[model samples]
Target: MTTSLVDAESVLAIEIGSIHTRALLFDVVDGQYRFIGAGRAPTTIHAPFFDISEGIHLAISHLQEITSRILLEESRLILPGKADGSGVDQVVLTYTAGQPLRVVVMGLLEDVSVESARRLAASAHTIITEAIGLNDRRPPEAQIDALLRARPDLIILSGGTDQGASRSIAKNVDLLTFALQIIPREKRPEVIYAGNHALVTPVKDVLSTYTQVHVAPNLRPEIDVENLSPAQDILADAEFHIRSRQIGGLQSYRSILAVEPLSAPFAFARMIRFLSRINNPGKGVIGVDLGAGNLIIASAFQGNSAVSVLPMGTGPGMAQALRTIPISEISRWLPIHIPESVVEDYLWHKTLHPTLLPVTTETAAVEQAAIRQVLWNGLNQHRTRYPNTPLLAEPILAAGMPLTQWSPQTSLMLLVDGLQPFGITTFVQDAHGLTAALGIISTNNAILPVQVIESNAFVNLGTVIVPLSNARYGTSILKVKVEYEAGNQISLEVRQGSVTALPIQTGQTARVHLQPLRPITIDPIGKDTTRSFKVIGGVCGVIVDARGRPLSLPTDAARRRDMLKKWAAGFGA
Candidate 1:
């Protein structure tokens, strides 16, 4: 078994989305890991071919042609390579195409355990069909009726402190058992007991007799403290178990997978946690995976982490986003003055032709405009659900179809104008979907993730500096100075409500200094009146977003359009 980064000479990572399945290849060059090539094919989990392995094989076929490497042996993969050179040493997989998991949460109290269960559901793309608790006004029989009506795929039973309750939990469990008996034996939802530790065996014994039972650590160890990571792990496992069977296609490739297949959103969230642990501990790390149908916002701060999976994205899977983000809101991000009706028509047309690439600049701009709105909507969802999780983070990472489909500068500006994050941070793009792959690979080979991440496996969008102040619009806000490694130096000033970029190419390094003109804070900590740091070059150099904290666009349509254009020009998009 490969236990370290150096042991693997070739790696193949696959991410299967609803619309597309992408195969990315990474290999060692001069004793260091590098992204070699990638291939894409339409996902075949639906319609005429219900097997996803067909899509996976086709993608790898393209990868073979691209690199002139033999990766397949007829119908099966050529694993562990051959002495004559044809195949990979390891293969990893992630997917985001399964049906959303439906859940029924039952707790002792409404605000304590029940709320925590809801948060757990929010961590993944799950629907809470019913929330039952001791505080529930309905009678026990009515609660049972509700649970059976919901027909949840999984039931989360959480309540009481570590050793607080026995009788109350038993009462709920007895009621749950009766409800399970009511449903057909094959239709019973799997149970997850995350309540008092003392009842673990009893809960499992009774529930396992009816259906599968998963035990997780107490979600609420104490009244004031909430522990969720372990429960989240169980949730992800249960989701994988439930969806793997639902898809049917995964069964064919399940035996050959290097590790257990992981849901793309859950894998992406785990990746964010790993990245956050290694990143700035005080600020936090936020990563977004905007897939074809769903978008996930994963944030980790200090020791706490939050994940929100929303039904929002670029093309075909935008029904939920449209309900919230109006045509005018999308138009606000467009540089051209297209009418709201026209913009809506374009989006509807794109939704129908989800795979069609934009041929005209107008259509592309409209698509990007909609993308900004989706990003904005996702950010708002994160803030609303997990307010305690800080948005001030370093290296805001973006992934999924939108990032890969658009230019780097376009992705950067959409993130800036949509997320509107404050303080100084770096912007990174996961165009290859390596973040999830690395996270999954780290489960077995811990060193591979660190080495590959430090290598050129991801794109560097550059450092983003946002100044916060109470200065009037158009007033000078911050002064920047850059001292290049070769001894060249320059300084500039930026006014409030505007954006600008510094000339720092990729693979270059410089020492940067900043001073707020009107006593603004550039870093997460408010005390830094002056700041200096060594920075690296990226696709877009140092960005000074003097656009202030709560980026507000002009009320007039034309004015907002021009302002959006100015920001795009600033990034040279």
Candidate 2:
């Protein structure tokens, strides 16, 4: 057998999200994947093809332009007067579809299986089109009609334990059959049964008669736990196939040594999960990908054992911020006061023209607020979709276009603190929003990315210490000891109802430990006297408690403004 020689040169991977398309060249320097020059451009989805090839071309062209400029500036440093050398070795293009793969959940009970199904889909970043179950009490025809109208890409059918509850499973299978009969033959959806194993063959036979049918092990094998791997993989594969068939110009992508274009993001996400788990076990990790048309929120919890994706994006946020919310809300968050009508006009223009640059400072502030609002809303929706998971020292990982222009305060409020009902221990941002690109590259070439993530690819923004005594709301629960290296120690008791802020500037480490003051009764949503936690410094930096409990929007406008201002000031935002 003859073996082909591989070149040592770098290969460039380009990722096109719903909003922005980016290109990054990667080369192994000192056996590490170092980022060479990069380029970016707007994604193209309005065109007839929605193929992603055209967007890739625009991104590559931008990269070429920027590379040319960089080479021109650095030419004197190198001999032989070379401005451009080899250009890009190879181009790998990956994209996320603007349209989410609508998901339908069929299960036994609304609480047991339906809720778990919602969490699985949310973690996968897929959309739930319809959630139907035995308790739902909707007629077979109603469920079928909803399925056909939604034209979901895949159906996640779950019910019963391994040998428990057959009526719900049988009923759900009948509903699947009804749905397949009504949907067009060519467009019949894919079905995955993660339910009772005894019914798997029945499900396959019923759905295979008219649509694509797949089966994974029961998601709720026991009443207590959820096994999502098999189902998630099946759903991810179906999504790839569906997008590949629909989005044109994918044939060019199939020629790559490995991976189809549509499947690259999933592949990348899986790789990140693998690495994150290996490094930080049982940590809740979240990644925010902000695109033009849609924003994808990917989250992983329990040592990367779980992941979910959300499709709400800045495009919709910009539109809603400009129209749905008042100009006064926008003004309150602005750095400097401006006319409400002027802000309205600016936001109106932005809503109509989604891609305009913020030319003035006032406009820039408005854009920042719009970004914050979008993230806040998106995170709220995320929490609601998947609730009641204890967050333990989780790091919020965010990558987006807006992050490239992220201010410290905006980053803190929107990223570090936004959507964190529990509390975020650290906030890490990908400067180029190219995690997907890195993710895709890591599949075949895993070493580079493995090193990158291990070696400071993520910046730690101090730690957040939360004191918990399992106490009821309004209880004085615990005491915290914070030891600073600068020869100072502070002891504080956590009080319920009021959020205590312990200031910790960036680059200062505090060692903090907690001691429960009393055995406190726990309240689900309300604050008790024992609701207090303490702060400490660590190897990373001083700990702060920015946990704004009693999740509520500022009701009094003036009071809300003052509170926000105080929060901003306290956090050094």
Candidate 3:
């Protein structure tokens, strides 16, 4: 006997950000999941409403008006759908508005278990205020003082293998317990033990009296292996629990969710992992979200994934982001001449008023410059964390207001100049900022993500071909021929140190053949060989960049402006 299975016919996913609350509707159409519609409203976590539910209801009301569907009944979400097709079958929520968890990591070895714990913290939206290791040369009194001053929300105690050392682990636990005793009971940090399993009971006994105690699998069970999923999961659960308790209306919001709300960064990371596993073999997927106060960079290869959350962004965190890179680094991307002081002032003003959009071309240019720096910082952090991961060669998904608010040309240029990937790569933007929403729904039901992604949830920005070479300027880098339907053909020569774009509408496909000149590499396999491959068109069409590896930009004032103008014209920017 065979059993029949049915998928949820209708679903509503909501994402509450620091400034905006967005809702997306998906329904099964013709036996496939499809994105129905989306609506957004200013987040009401603060000010007049002071209730997140208000913003969610308003956003859903907008969706109801758009689709003529009744999602809310008496200020409550209608669940399991209605016989009249007026409700949804399920609802999921994700958020990124609350303060990041303040965490302190304690480990035995600085490079061993300590490093693994640090990587786990990096995977979530957290601020590592202090990390204590056994190698510290400071006196125990001073160390305890620093730990007490940090005032962490949680403590991650990890050291020792499954059956390794117990004496040293007890010593570290003793120190942590003493520190917790000094603090008030209501203010003590929760403890998560991810150390030797054999000592979990003893460790809990020592710390449980001071605060809540949770246990996870050892982060470094063996010296040769680093198991982070267990720790990552526990950390995310703890963060949600703490956030729901601290935020004013989130506790009530939690009661309505079918499942616990997930952090935006965690959900986004999972979505990237799922996409990387399903699509693209032997490569990885990179998803970047540049929020007002945070930047999330998630990469997934096969089934392994890593997320790096940088606390600096365009709004509340802009001042810190500015200190990381020099003013000249951002000014180089601006086509027009702007003084460093003026650029600095613009960033300061933006930090004060993040919702303000660029009103003029000059301001727009400055905004894009800041975006480039943010992307650079995100990519740099990814590289530092996962040095051996493959290049961002697969489809790249970009989110956040900066990319969505700007024209496709300008957004694409900013990405290209910042990442500078070689070979063939496809770039796409999260058209409706549904990455986190889709990710949460996908976790509950696997078929939903495939359905929504197939329904054109993302806007394809086209494929780019960048040849890696260091040939002299003005030299012929490669000869390209593009053949489409009806025997139409376009043949052109791209020069070294130049950026060129070819027009191709979205949903169009072309057969591209490349013949590289001597000492020039078109494909990643061989530098001096000819290559042929099929390419897809997008809103920004096809861009062929032969601007040698390291992507040199002219330093002289006059020449730099001329070069910028030429590149901008090529991309219709």
State which candidate has the highest lDDT: 3
Clashing residue pairs, candidate 1? Answer: none
Q: Could you estimate the TM-score for every candidate? A: 0.94, 0.74, 0.95
lDDT against the true structure, each candidate: 0.82, 0.61, 0.83
* Index of the highest-TM-score prediction: 3
Give every collision pair in model 3.
none
Tens digit per residue, CA lDDT, model 2, 464-519: 54443445545766676766778697888765433455545455655555566665
Whose lDDT is higher: candidate 1's or candidate 3's? 3
The digit string of per-residue lDDT tens for model 3 on 261-370 reads 88899899889989988877756888888888888888888868888888878887687788888888888878898898999899989889999889998888888888
Error of 3 at 22 (Å): 1.5
lDDT of model 3 at position 566: 87
What TM value does model 2 have? Answer: 0.74
For model 2, give the 10-residue run with minimal summed lDDT: 72-81
Candidate no. 3 TM-score: 0.95
Query: What is the number of backbone collisions in each predicted candidate, taken in the order shown?
Result: 0, 31, 0
